[model samples]
Target: MSGRRGEAGSALVEVTWLAILLLVPLVYVVVGVFEVQRAAFASTAAARAAGRAFVLAADPAEAQQRARAAAAVAMSDQGVDGGAVVIGCRPACLVPGSVVEVQVSYQVPLPFLPDALGRQAPSIRVHAEHTVPYGSFREDRS
Candidate 1:
């Protein structure tokens, strides 16, 4: 009976060790997935907002400024960096029926990863694009 009593705690110790090793990694993966999803959502929203803002502007110069501002605001609202926005415009963007395109990109860092391994760990890049067409009623002031 004495010999059996000492070995009883051994199973509990083994189980605890296994749980720690598995659960920690599982939690990290879940958090990383959530971060990626957030980046995707932010990028999409930023592109849409930028395109719409550009089409509604009074002139070409104002359109560019407004698009950038709108994209920045949209990304920031979702806790993403707004500096990565890229706007692409079709020829004669202010002309009637012209198209305005906006693209937003974000790099999502891995959760609980060391900065030193940043190069080794592949960062997820999320990108979204939206195109808006100018109204047919737009007047050609030039």
Candidate 2:
């Protein structure tokens, strides 16, 4: 009975160690995946909002400014910071039926990593692009 009791404790210790070694890392990986997915969602939303803002603006200069602001706001809402945004227009901007494209890029750092290590770690980058057409009813300014 004494030997059997000792062996029972040993099995529990082994299981505890296994959980520590395996389960913890698994949980971290799952959380990291969730963060990356969040970044991806943010990027897509930013691009779409920027493109729509650009298309709705009345002038080319205003379109660029609105697109940038819209993208920044969208990304910040999702807990992402310092994301890069790019905007492009087909043919000429502010023209009726012109297509506006907005792209957002975000780098997601791994959780629990030190700054130096995080910088060295392979970053998960999420990119999204959206295109919207300008209103066809707008009168040509030129």
Candidate 3:
């Protein structure tokens, strides 16, 4: 009778500790997922900005440069300062129909948690392509 009561208390204590241990790792994984999603969103926005700039450019080389610049600007605006924005142009990225490809990379840190899950932190890459029609502007000479 007394032994059964003591066993119950010990079991409860053990279960409590186990719950805490499992909870920490679960929380860390959730946080890591959230960070990855944020990174993807930032990269996608940068790609879109770059693509828009490229499509409107008159010169292919200039367009590529402009796309890179736009991507950087967009990344900065999105509060992501540690990633690289790469713009690959025609023959490689641009199509005959005024399309551009933008590649964005971001390195994510591992959230604090137990390391038993073997989820190694890795850099994530997001690639996006956008096709834009060139905007027309009338030349003015006085």
lDDT of each: 0.82, 0.85, 0.66
Residue-wise C-alpha lDDT for candidate 3, range 1-142, written one tens digit per residue: 8768757668788999999999988987888788777777777888888888877666667777888888888777767675776665444434443334567777755555344569665544544444454423422111
If ranked by TM-score, best first, what sequence of candidates would result? 2, 1, 3
lDDT of 2 by residue, 33-90 (tens): 9999989999999999999888777777888888899988998898888689999877
Q: TM-score winner among the candidates?
A: 2
Better model by TM-score: candidate 1 vs candidate 3: 1
The Cα error of candidate 3 at residue 112, in Å, is: 3.9
Residue pairs clashing, model 3: none
Scored by lDDT, model 3 comes in at 0.66
User: How does each model score on TM-score?
Assistant: 0.86, 0.88, 0.64
Off by over 4 Å in 3: 57-66, 91-97, 113-122, 131-142
Better TM-score candidate (2, 3): 2
Candidate scoring better on lDDT of 1 and 3:
1
Q: How many clashes (backbone atoms < 3 Å, residues ≥3 apart in a chain or on different chains) does model 2 have? A: 0
Tens-place lDDT per residue, model 1, 1-142, is: 9879878879889999999999998998899999999889988998999999888788778888898899888888989876477776666777876777788888887777676754666688888988887766888522
Model 1 regions lying over 4 Å from their true place: 117-122
Query: What is the clash tally of candidate 1?
Result: 0
Candidate 2 lDDT trough over 10 residues, lowest sum: 114-123
